[model samples]
Target chain A: MRLVLLIFSFCDWLQRTPVASYMRASFWAFPLVESLHILCGNVPLLVATSILSARLAGWGLREVPVSKLARGLLPWAWTGFLIQVITGLLLFSSAAAKYASTRIFPLKMLLILLAGTNALIFMRTTYRRVAAWDTAEVPPLGARFAGVVSLLLWSSVLVMGRVLNSAVSLVVAAHLWFAR
Target chain B: MPDFLSWCQWLESTPMSATLRDSLWLFPAIETVHLFGIVALVGSTSILDLRLMGFTLAGTPVPKLARRVLPWAWLGFGIQAATGFFLFAAEASRVYLNPAFRFKMLMLVAAGLNALLFHVMTSRSAAQWEGRSTTPMSAKIAGLSSLALWFAIVIAGRMIAYFE
Candidate 1:
């Protein structure tokens, strides 16, 4: 109710900003930013996270200590995450209201939130005990569980993000069919 | 060129292409899979590239890392090729004419050649430098060029949509 209204108003305000206007007006800005988002942002973050998660699950790289793998990969993951945040904000600003209204966009955001939460919980809990099983062929149950959930949630986020564009077309087609 | 264009036209007319183009869900589904393939392909390759450049994972032997990581890269490549072929089939003629698509194909070839040349020339001496902190100059060159080409391929692939 009030929260939804606040969100919509915020989106409207965002869409009216100069950054949004510039994003819309410049022919190359949107696409170029999107390319950067996909290449440097989403890909690296997903890859680094996936590798870490896979190791946590005792899937591969069993020889490398979990702490060492995390040390090496977390920087890449953070860099990618930073790029994603900047580019995502730029993209959202371009059509904030429309994106806010889209079902897929909200869903994508929710999944990302969940993924982040999963990572945090894992870090605070099982990951704190990583030294006990850092090089184990099979990690503890908590670590493996966290790894699997993280993988699924992040993959869903990716799917939802990619489907955002096509989902709009599907909605339009449904609307047209109903109108006819 | 004319023959290639005709072949593209023929591909566009095929029933499979028509089905993919007409269906809203199928194309997006395949495209999502294609994105996953890119993640796996580029992700695994980048790990190895960073290692070869002595930037990260310096302690791991080159052969050991390659043996572990290259399988995933090959798997990703298989997924990319299969999905990419279907995607190309869906809009063969238009994509054939697309400059971005053409550039992406060129980069893919270049990336492939770089990998092959590295395997043939640089990696042949893996016995000599497998555990060294710094890789040979040729390996570093191959790694850097590969990273550049793949990133270029990703950009070009994204541009195909905007160009269209």
Candidate 2:
């Protein structure tokens, strides 16, 4: 209950802030911000997951050790993940109550959390043993599992994002009909 | 040109377009698929471009990386093209006239040309620098151009909604 109250107060405060109003009122701000968010947010996730998964599956990157590839690619992934959070929060703040009501919104957050947890686990467990199979064509079972999980979770997050739009529109339409 | 736009208007008025425009689920669902294609296409191209630019995966041969990644890139482009057609068909008139849409189409053309020129000019002799730490200047230029053009296409694509 306290958590819910804290959320409500935080959202209320966010809605009253200057940034939220500006985002909502501006004609191009929302779409442009959303563009940046999706591009920066999902692209890295896709790229990192795809390449890492391929490396894990022994599909490519045979010459370079897996550790080197991961090291090189992870900075971009981190950059993207950070951008997503910032832009996503701004977008959400512009319509907090509306977004909070949408089912897909929570699912999207959950997916992101799951993806993050999966990455952390991978880093801690399979990735710690990188020296053993760094150049092996097929990575060990755990690393492969983490790669696949990351891919699936991120993909679902994309789907959830798209669905959020539909869910919001449906809710709005229903509200209009009921009010009439 | 008027005739072409008129044809677009006609296309937009079709039942299929109605479903895409009016049905909330269908539009976003198709758009999600479109995003998937973008991820696949752009994601793959970006990696290959980075490799060409001598940024990452230095141990992997250029030709080998290209051979692995380009197919996925092409597949993504193909998916985008198919889904894009459906999307354009749904809002043909609006998209036909939108400046952002026009910009996106132009950038896509530029991207295509850049890819083709790279393939014909630079990539033909990829074997010479395949394992080298640094690529030739021409390869670097092509890689840089590809990176810039594809990202421009992405920005232009996202602007379509705001402009419309």
Candidate 3:
């Protein structure tokens, strides 16, 4: 837990410090980066969803060999996640002081932590067993569980990301209104 | 101007329905969960959807991809179904009244019933189209509807807030 806090603190710092001023100077690129992140986020979401619906009808990936499908989609999702993190940091850096004091900041951290943890578990527990599920002619419950967890967590992360800005604004608005 | 949507607002805020109003945060959180679930869902589904739209995996059999990825997809759908019910629970009255919500439900039903129809139609056709990289026109239509209806469902889901 301490280690997790420590890492988040460091991220909190970089996101605040604008330590690499050059990154901050490249401010014009933020929207482009963010849009790319949105694209990455949306496309995979579409694909991953339909797959789940088909499966519930008692079909496993082996029949259609979706193991590689897992492999195929991970990179896209990861790439999108990476872009969000980078640009997110950049946005944070541009206005570090304000966010540092905001409750919204911490909430973002908790959600990001969940996303990262979900990703790690996904690769280790779920992605690791694709071939075995294919070879054994049985879908491993562990992998399925991991898949379920991943689906839930990433969905949270995306919504959290989308709402983070608005939420912060809303909090600020409520604060200001209440203060008056 | 929008009488129905205004009715939705009244329902959401009914003092007698404090139980529902007090619980807005919970459903949104569940939605957050559903959001992630769909990520995994789309990841698995797109492979098959695209396959239905005629993109084939090299060497690996079509059934094989379907078998492997479908669980991940349905796992998402399952999470969605569970969470979806909660979201409705949170604002059941409002959702029941909103036009966008109605359309969303219609699209969901369309997607669901179409999915069942596709399965029945395709399973019979499986022997003929089975393992073939390219799907028949009907299967492609199924693929298209699956994609389109879900797209509408998501957009409506997202837009329900805005429209209301």
Candidate 4:
């Protein structure tokens, strides 16, 4: 498709950038940036969002109002997400074409998009009525559904991210095995 | 040190460890569980830490919040310990040689000790200040230290592969 070609061209451009070249050239840069990505972005984002989801599902933290928990925690979730976007982009730029071609990368991105859409729909619908059962031990069915779905989606995204890393190693291992 | 090295070697030869190392799917599967375990563990701990620091959910008493969150943290801890042992067993000899792995172990001990100390010292007096929006200075210090140590642990854990 023309769109796919366009996207690949964009990836090619990104991969050719000076920053991308530096990321590939430097030994410490990739790992250090990756450590930062996991620590700052993935960890906090998953934690905050998981806690929020848990609360929505009536799994824990029953005393705190949902709104209060969301208010306190959503900021952290957003902050983590912001960091994820920045770090993810930086990492992607280094091997844009390869990442674009990878199945796992697209899968991870799709999971993220679905997670975001789930949150958006929840906020627009069930969450609009949060006041009704904000402190209830069991939130409405819709909120709980959203919560469970979000948890599974986000966790899958995490797994896929890890899988993406391992997939590369697997390829290298296969190459080595062939070489041997 | 020699005794430890031999122990690691023995672990590496065990049937369980051999299975984990040989299987393509098993290692990644367990590692994925380990990742989720971290979410539960660090996620619960951070919630409590944030509350203790008067950052969030101040309206809820500390004891009440602890009652709600600590179980999940313990569950997460149990998962981590179990999965971590398997992971260590799979590559015990090599991991023992890894500086990052060694550092992670030290950080884990320190983090555990920090938590134990908080429970013994600061948390005993939690009842007195549980209602206040601002926690005692000691509690804040404990929370801050736990957060820092856990983040360090995660970073160190990630660096294990890089080091190897």
* Least accurate 10 contiguous residues by lDDT in model 3 chain A: A49-58
Give lDDT tens digits, candidate 1, residues B10-119. 99999999999999789999999999998899988988898888888777888888998999999999999999999999999999999999999999999999999899
> What TM-score results for chain B when candidate 2 is compared with the true chain B?
0.94
Best by DockQ: 1
| Model 4 spans > 4 angstroms off | A172-180
TM-score of chain B of 3: 0.78
Q: State candidate 3's DockQ.
A: 0.15
Q: What TM-score does structure 1 among the candidates reach?
A: 0.93
Stretches off by above 4 angstroms in model 2 are: A57-64, A169-180
Docking class of 2: medium
Model 2 lDDT on a 0 to 1 scale: 0.84
Best by TM-score: 1
Q: If candidate 3 were superposed on the true structure by all CA atoms, what would the RMSD be?
A: 8.0
DockQ of each: 0.71, 0.66, 0.15, 0.58
> What 10-residue stretch in candidate 4 chain A is worst by lDDT?
A165-174
What shift in Å separates residue A23 of candidate 3 from its native position after superposition? 23
Top candidate, metric lDDT: 1
Candidates 1 and 2 compared by TM-score, better number = 1
| lDDT by residue for model 3 (B85-147), tens | 666655656677777788988998998898789877767756665556666788678877887
Weakest 10 consecutive residues, lDDT, candidate 1 chain A? Answer: A165-174
The CAPRI classification for model 1 reads as medium
- As for candidate 2, its clashing pairs are none
Lowest-sum lDDT 10-residue window in model 2 chain A: A45-54
Docking class of 4: medium
